[model samples]
Target: MTKKRHAEIAGAGFAGLAAAAALGQRGWSVRVHEMNSELRAFGAGIFIWDNGLRVLNAIGAYLDVRNGAFAAPAYETRTDGKCLSFQAINGPGQYRLLTMTRQHLHAAMVKAALAAGAELVTSSEAVGATPEGELLLADGSRLPADIVLGCDGVRSRVRDSLAIPQERNKYKDGIIRVLTDRTGLKGGEWDHVIDFWAHSPRTLRILYTPSGENDLYMAMMAPVADTEASSIPINPAPWIECFPQLAPALTRLGDRGRYDVYETTKLPYWSVGRVAIVGDSAHAMPPTLAQGAGCAITNALGLAVALEETDTVEAALELWEKRERPLTDHTQRRAAEIAASRVLASGMKWDDEGLRAARHIPTGAAMPFVDAA
Candidate 1:
């Protein structure tokens, strides 16, 4: 009898957990090791576009994640409180967008991954994967697996162990993210996500979206230099001057954190030997596109499909790389373009192809089992 395939996934973030859930559902014995004693979630939100929803559906966490989300039919762009473009994003349920807190989505994914029978080991840090198909844990013990997946995120030690050539670029801006309950905010759908832009002093943009239950996610983007000055006021007075619409949400800032934005070019290659990388470990982009987490989810589904189509570990990794690399590379480029435009209009070069392909993502979309593998 053939032995059941097993996968070792490092980290318990959305990508790791979702990939675990996907592989476990496919009859693969999956073990996920999280470096943190307990998974930590920031008081922030995420944009799960239709493309991402499709992957969630494939992994069996779509409905549960959606239950705690607010789906919006429109994406509005505003300048100085005046609506510039209110684009209707209406589509079939699969082609819609959902906004919710990272905590809720993470919690749902955790439940799905556990239910799917993926073993979750906490406080376990992966040292590296061996050529002999063994995963070296920090405690000097080794876990055997058919494959080792690096879902350990942007600062992935697995990716570092591969020693592949990679490029890292920092955006010229930083973000201030805050989460607060929507106690007194009025008007709009309350569930809607809005992008409000400001032109005076310097180009800046703020995103407002619903997070969890009665919670709001807001992030203000500005030049990194402007934010470096300790004298610069951290309050909302100047922001309110730029865009008055922010007054309602800014009045209730309960928790906040500063985010330094960075985008890394695609890795030279995502896999070597029995080890391979996924999610931000492969491509980390600025939030300008909001597709970081989305791509992670899809990568999980695609990798699972590749595994199902092939018997050999090398072949499966190759197929997974071929199918996923191009998409992620293009997404990084597109995200860079969007980030440029957000920072300064002079760098406005859009990815028309990406926009078109993304519009048709379906609710039941799953990775295809191509014969090439």
Candidate 2:
């Protein structure tokens, strides 16, 4: 009889959960450790493109996500209160896109991973990792496994512990994301995702997205240097003056909104020996392209597929990075470029180029795996 392989993953975010589900379905024993007392997603809303949807489907989480998410018919852009462009996103050949609260997506992923037999350990923190496939816990203990994965965000202690060469760049622009009630908000434009930009008085931007049926996600973007616009508890005066149409939504903002500055993380390589880095720990990029979660989910599943094919853990890590890094790197570069320029061009060619990775089929999407009953 063969011994079952075990994987110890740090962080219970999108990357960690996806990896857990993928590996558990392949008959591996998986344990995910999260630092928080309970698993919770931080962002207000998230975009799941075609590539991400395929990963969710392969992991048997798509049905849950679809039931709670909103599929926008089109993507619209407005500048200075004037419509700049409106592109249909639900056409026959177009890739699928869905918007949902981070909480909703996280819940669905948790259900899928749990159903696949992955154990979740909360209030446990992983401080570091070793190349010998050992996870270092915060309480002066080490857990050994066949593989160790660091899906812990930008400040990944696992990645740092391995001394992986990397660069972290922080951009000047940031966003305040809040989820508001959708009740009583009236507008036909609410059916579509809208990007409202104000480049005149200042570089203020709002990304309006409908999530589920009762919630609206609004991301107010402004330079970090702009004290008034970037302040917490968000002053609705400036925003209302700029986007009068969104007065209702803006006024409902609470102090609990999250503010995050744009950042890009580039690692020379994603792994060392039996330990591998995934998601924001390896390649965190600007949200301009909204591919952060998508890329994370894709790579996590790709890692599981590589391990199934390779003979050793180290070899599988190498193969996974080789196969997945190119596209991820390209996506990061494109996202950074768009963020720096602050200009979003609308057209089929532009959209195709920007979303190249979103159209690519993930490694395990076509392969068959045991579905969780």
Question: Top model by TM-score, which number?
Answer: 2
In model 1, the worst 10-residue window by lDDT is 343-352
Candidates in order, TM-scores: namely 0.89, 0.96
lDDT of 1 at 73: 61
Residue-pair clash count for candidate 2: 0
Report lDDT (CA) for all predictions.
0.75, 0.89
Q: What is candidate 1's CA lDDT for residue 84?
A: 62
| lDDT of candidate 1 over 26-109, digit per residue (tens) | 899999999888876666888887688777777778778878787666667676656665655546542467888888889889
Q: How accurate is candidate 2 locally (lDDT)?
A: 0.89
Task: Write model 2 residue lDDT over 198-250, tens digit each, in one string.
Answer: 87787789998998788899888888998899888788888888888888788
Report backbone clashes per prediction.
0, 0
TM-score of 2: 0.96
Candidate 1, lDDT over the whole model: 0.75
Off by over 4 Å in 2: 345-350, 367-373
